[model samples]
Target: MEDLRGAFAIVTGAAQGLGYAIARAYAQEGMRLALMDVQAERLAQVADELNAQGGDALPLVVDLADAADTERAAAQALAHFGTPRVLVHNAAILINRPFSELTLADWQREVNVILQAAFLLTKAVWPLMVTAGRGSLVYVSSMSGIKGFVNESAYCTAKHGLEGFMKCMALEGRPHNIAANTITPGMYMHTPMSERNYPDELKQKWVDPMLLTPAFVFLARQDATGVTGERLNAWELSTNPPA
Candidate 1:
């Protein structure tokens, strides 16, 4: 893999959870980062922590459900850091409401965070990556991406669309040496979302999200020739990256 020291990265949902872990991992690699999240105070705390560790960190608060906000944040990152070596769209919200109980607003909120923001962010980065001749794109996906679940129609639909989007981008990215891929945690994680939604059985099996950051660090160094289009399992790749 190429050296990522001083390289740029953009990570969404970076205030906490897997996104936080990924940002920490990238900082360890000596990468500069733009950390985007909806939680302003928490996001600022995260940036301060990384910055104190001798990392260059920028915090951008954004409500990704709003297109204009999403576009503005993406523009800010690009304006500040130029083209990023990797862009990780890790932000998503899962509200478990039965189809009967779901409101259109709730549906839109979940879908927009997972799918719409992915598009706007990727679209913003596409030209820069193409001009730079290489970049990596990672969309955090889950089992919902490929399978249906009760009380997760909106979340599932968005995840499903995210994976499909990655595939198409991967194909388009090939000639430019850009890589686009989706990754599943492949293990129950001890994140706020999982804490709220996990069954007792799965919570017992949950691992720290930090344990999965190795997979993301690996993804950050990729170009189309290394990996693209596949749905990767973080547990497997983090433990044993391919030679």
Candidate 2:
């Protein structure tokens, strides 16, 4: 395994939930961080907490749905830490509105944050990762990525697009030794989004998001030759990592 000590990582949606858990995991691995989120105060608190624990964290307040703001955030990260060992695009918004009730603006915001921001962030970091000769890009996906749900028209569409985009990136990145993959929670978790969406039954079975961070930490050590273009289960991978 690659030595993650002092490695750099950029995590979006890092103010709370799964993203927060991943940030903590990276910190424990001795990785420096550039955390992006819309929640300014919460983001600073997380950064302070990590810094207090001997972790290096730079908190960036950004609205992922705004293309310009997303680009600026990526630029700042690059300036602070030249090339990231990993880029985890975990920022996504889910609004449960029926098709009949959903406005075009509503659909656009969700797609912009989840899909458009993915493209923007990846595009900004692509050259750096290529020059560095190795990198891992992980997009947090879900069952909604492949299956349709009752009130997730925009979300499902963007997730499906995300999978396709990763496939293309994986194919292209293979030549440059950059790995690209999508990962689903695989099991229910106690996240802000889950709290809003999960039923009582799933909540009862839900585990802490921290339990799934091992899979992410493993992926952080990978290159194109290691599990690219795959849709992985975080729960399964964490339970039994690759040999």
Candidate 3:
């Protein structure tokens, strides 16, 4: 395992689900955290819990879909930690509706949160990572980006765009030692959103979000050198990490 003690990380959508699991893993590794989410109360509670455990966690509540809000949140995190060594773009919204039924607003909202927000946040932190000459950017991608899914046109489109965007970022960041990659969680988990859409039995068969923590931790490690612009399977990497 790569040692990440004394480093700092920024995790978007960290109030719960996979984002929360990633943050907890980072905290366990002694990394300070800036947890961003739209849920103010939940974000504060998560931050407080981590801080109580002798971890440095700051909660910033902002609508990530808004470029201005994302920029401000990024500024706050940077001011608090100077330059974070890791950034995980984990915020996403899924409006599951058939293409014929989906409204323009629905498509726009999903795109803004999943693709546009990632762009804004990455842009906000890009300079810092370059200045430090090293960093890691892990995008929380999904199978929706790789294959077509019914009633998920908007989500799929945004994720596909995210993958392409990360590839471009990887090329640009290569010179700066900033690794950029996409991690696709192949199955659903017991997230609040998933719970609403999936039956209990189906959810039980799915992998737990925490099971993918190792993959995120691995990608966030400063020692993770020469790995960029690649698409990773979280389930696979969790059991068999890259050397």
Candidate 4:
């Protein structure tokens, strides 16, 4: 595995849930972090905690749904830590409503956060990665990307788009030594968002978000020669790492 110590990583939606877990894991590896989230207060709290633990972290408050905000966040991150070796596009919004009830506004909101933001952020960071000739771009995907689910029209569509986008990135980034891939948690976790949608009983049966961190860490450390354009299951990767 590549050494992560002293490397810079940018993780979006890092104020809570899987994003927070990914940031925490990176901090433990002694990696410097740029943590972005729409929640300013919570993002600050996470950064503070990491700093207290002797980790280098910067909190960037941003609404990914806004193109300008996404661009600004990327610029701030690059300014703080030039050309992050790892970029995790984990910011997303889920609007669960029946197909008939979903409005154009709801669909647009979901698509902006889940798809457009990824494009903008990646575009912002692309030149830096090319200059470095080594970088990892990880899209936090879901089963919804591959399978349709009721009441998740917007989310599923966005994720499906993300999957295709990552593949194109992988192909284009090959010559530059930038690896782009997708990782699916494959099980529900007891996150703040999930708690709002899942019953306590159901949440108890789901895997911990932390369990999915290994795959992320692994991908971050890898170069383009490693793995790209692949959809990996976090749960399986955590149990048995790819050879």
Candidate 2 accuracy as lDDT: 0.94
Identify the runs in model 3 with alpha carbons over 4 angstroms from their true place. Answer: 199-201, 222-224
**Structural similarity to truth (TM-score) of each candidate:** 0.99, 0.99, 0.95, 0.97
* Candidate 1 TM-score, C-alpha based: 0.99
Which scores better on TM-score, 2 or 4?
2
lDDT of 4 by residue, 1-243 (tens): 667999999999999999999999999999999999999999999999999999999999999988998899899999989988989999888998999999999999899999998899889889999999999999988988899999999999999999999999999999999999989987778688797788778877977799889888898887689888899888888779877
On the 0 to 100 scale, the lDDT of residue 76 in model 4 is 92
- What is the per-residue lDDT of model 1 for residues 25-73, given as tens digits with 9 covering 90 to 100? 9999999999999999999999999999999999999999999999999
Per-prediction CA RMSD (Å): 0.7, 0.6, 1.5, 1.1
The list of candidate 1 runs beyond 4 A from truth reads none
Total colliding residue pairs, candidate 1:
0
Give the Å error, residue 164, model 3.
0.1
Off by over 4 Å in 4: 199-201
